[model samples]
Target: MHHLFMVTLKTEQSKRKQAFFWINAMAPLTSVILGSILVYMTHAEKHGVQVIGHLKKGLNPPSVSELGFGSPYLMTAIKAGATIGIISLAEGVAVGRSFAMYKNYHIDGNKEMIAFGMMNLVGSLTSCYLTTGPFSRTAVNFNAGCKTAASNIVMATAVMMTLLFLTPLFHYTPLVVLASIIIAAMLGLIDYGGIIHLWTIDKFDFFVSISAFLGVVFGSVEIGLIIAVTISMLRLLLTLSRPRTYALGNIPNSITYRSIEQYPAAANVPGMLILRIDAPIYFANTSYLRERISRWIYEEEDRLKSAGETSLHYVILDMSAVSSIDASGIHMLEEVRKNVDRRGLQLALANPGSEVMKKLDKSKMIEKIGEEWMYLTVAEAVGACNFMLHSCKSTSAALTNPAAVEPNTYDYV
Candidate 1:
């Protein structure tokens, strides 16, 4: 009854919302009263149905002195605290974000973190339970139509009153009734659309989600979190170790170049190969890039041979996307240069950033690669290659005069 009342209120008249809200609000209390009466009237407690027996009517006592800061198990406590704290923090922030996105609202993450941190800090002294917002509680409050932080104030006040004077009222309340209410609230939070969307867009994310769900269902929250994190890290490392590269081609009647696979109409310049790296050049991906570049060269040669087109002469690397390079990257480039030289091809670099330029200069690669071969953009690189090969009709003529080249200059099969 606490879960679906919001939908009922939405369907009613605007003026009737206020009246229906009170009735919806009374459902839980009514259930508690009725369940307690039933349990009492039927003597269910004596028949093994558990109930919240007795009452403790008082304010919290000081537990500061009970804290064993200097105990021998302090290190163990710290380790456990750190692990649980991290998992709780991540879960709390994630829940806040999920609800905020669902309701089309914004929340300041830093403010939320600080507020939860302060709550936990003060709570520790008073022997209060750890205070990160749990998803089940958030779902219940969300279904109850809580609009702002004021709901927390109301909750705190009600809890205080319950501790002081209303303790005896719940003494005969059946625990099963409360559990059922919580389960119903949680059921409303399971988003079927999100799961299907993830499955359609990204299979890996869907698999990870399933793994976490299974872990939590069969084991515990910690187990689920660890499995999700491990799979995520593995994916990250895999992508970093083998970053993707693309073959760029000129767009007809335009100076811009883009991936040929993406733009099927883009034209490939004869006698030259253009490639772009989509990640930083580092030790992790350098070796894979070397083999991949070699394969591209061989493949280009085979295609040109089959077409009886202009023999491959130049290899231009569009380095605008490659932001940085390390020692292994420099070595990989040196090896690539040697390989290109052995194939009787000239190697050219286009749009190397400041970081890459500095590393290349320090490694004496700038002098070896020749400053004259380096161009500011891929168009200029292609123009130079075309001019050298004396096939200036498509690329070089297009750069010198926009209208000199024909549309669909040179399409790759």
Candidate 2:
């Protein structure tokens, strides 16, 4: 009831009317008090009602001496603390940002983390558990319509009063009432709409959500964390190992070339296969790329043969997007060059960047492919291939000058 506010309560508060507003605000307190009184009157503890039992009145004794820094279990304690701390930080910040977005407010993440760290450090000395802005209590506070953090000060004062004077009153309070309050607060956080939206948008994300949720409910929070992390890493590795490749074609009336699949009007040049790699070349994807390139060449040849088009003559690789390459990538290039030569097709490289040129220089690959075969741009490579094709008289006239094809100049290291 405290979570719900009536519209009438907001309008013009007189002395008596304002006094009545406190009733809605203190509904949880009323419930606790009535539950405690009823339990006490019925002597429910004797009937196994599981009351709160004795309450300690006073302050926390310093537990600094219990640090056990020199104990043999120090390493284990450190490991446990580090694990729980990581999970706590992840969950707290995630929930905090959600509420911050919902409320349309801003918060400094670094300050929030620093405050939590200081609180936990100080709290540990006073025998308190590790502190975090957990979702349960956060949801409860949000539902109560807290306008500002000053509510925490009021709550702290009330708690202090309870500890100093009202300890005996809660001794008969049933644990069920407290649990019910927490459960009610947590019910607002289920977010079924979010789960359904995830399923509609992305199956993988939905799978991750369900896996984490079920793991936490059945196994443990740590197990859920492990599952989520494992699935995410697997997805990352799969994407890297099979990075996208595009069959490029020239955009009409322009020197620009783009993916044939992406640009429907882009026309494919006869007797040539132009391909683009959309990711960096690395050891993880080297083998996959080798097979993928071979497959592209094979598929292009098959498509040409089926259509009775000009025989596949040249294989042009657009290296504009390949930012980096390792030794394995260099080897893959060599293997691809050899395969193209074996298939009686001329292989040309175009627009490889400074880093790729440097790697090629280091591997003595520029000398093998030669300066005449490498071009400053894919369009220039296509021009050289078209000159070699002997299909168009006007294109032949355009490429009559040898300097028409600009080759990349690389200084070997």
Candidate 3:
């Protein structure tokens, strides 16, 4: 009895899923089926210019070629219609995902795809190409107290009744009016405000949007989607290449060390640079990291040369922020160690995670840099390097203090 009850529950769940799928697919299937039949009929009539057409056309003339019939223009019209429909559905589903977040509802993407597929399958059989979820109609339903799929039944019933009884009434509706509706729908997709907003937020995003817009307007819609996706991926790689680095220090009355640029009152590690890498070390960004470190080394060398001094002494790499490492990164680290040693500067690594440490160990970097150079904490690393713990004097005093800071005439000039 228990097993039978559980089996029955599973069957009910499966039926509900099927029901929801049908609900989502029905509207697009019906709309496209009807629209296609109308197109086929109008083409058969081959009505060139009626009294109603002349009345609809103002003093400003419009194109009189009706493409609903079997012509070269008819194929182009159908192609354009399919393109617009697919784009509308893509944009609609994205909006639905956003609203689903606020409404605390879960959307099954695979099920939605099945529904969408069925819509196209049924629509094509009825002399249509393809149709998709209409954003405007869905939004209207959402606003008008549509709680369940039952609302669609009422809506479909009304539409069917209208089609059966009021066919003659729609004959008086001008061709120009229908054309205007199609044009309006297409125009809605050209999101000028969205483009502007993307530009304001990120210059890279602006470039991407511009590329996509131009591709769509000047080239083809298919080409535009391809260009947009490609550009997005390239932008992601570029971002990873220049991961943000910060000089971290302890905030007053707080144990947590934050970026000195963020908190002015934070205690800095004088005579020692505490640098934090804000990303995983990988082949893509290895050269970028090297360049940044090289810049700092060059600046330090120039200061030392003017003061008749030797070195900045120590650089503490705070690796607590690093979550992972790759083979290219290991090679980069070895090169950095060699370069720093050749320059008579000490390079110490602090707080490498277990995974990173294991990689470092496998790479045999710990012994090359010395086990003493590896510390669990930044403070311990600084102490091992024989750097001062606290700043007794202010930064102004340190700048003027001969013992703390060597005089560099070249820096002043």
Tens digits of lDDT, candidate 3, 283-376:
9999999888777667656766687664466777889878999999989899888888887777899999999999999999999998978999
TM-score of 2: 0.77
Candidate 1 lDDT over 48-94, as tens digits, reads 98999998996688788898778999999999999888888877887
Tell me the lDDT of candidate 2. Answer: 0.82
Q: For each candidate, what is the lDDT?
A: 0.84, 0.82, 0.66
Between prediction 2 and prediction 3, the one with superior TM-score is 2
* Candidate 2 C-alpha error for residue 400, in Å: 17
Please give, for residues 1-413, the per-residue lDDT of candidate 2 as tens digits.
Answer: 33222211321132146555554354555567877988889999999889888989986789998877788889999999998898887767766876887678888889888988998999999988789887667866764456698998987798889889989889998887776555555554567988999999999999988998787668855677678878989998998899899899999999999999999999899999999998899999999999999999999999999999999989999999999999999999999999999999988999999999999999999888877889989999999999977866557766896565556476332
lDDT of 2 at 399: 84
lDDT of 3 at 165: 67
Candidate 2 Cα RMSD after full superposition onto the native fold (Å): 8.1
For lDDT, the strongest prediction is: 1
TM-score of each model, paired residue for residue: 0.84, 0.77, 0.56
- Lowest lDDT 10-residue stretch of candidate 2: 3-12
Which regions of candidate 3 are displaced past 4 Å?
Answer: 1-179, 182-200, 206-224, 249-268, 304-310, 370-372, 376-380, 383-413
Q: Per lDDT, what order, best first? A: 1, 2, 3
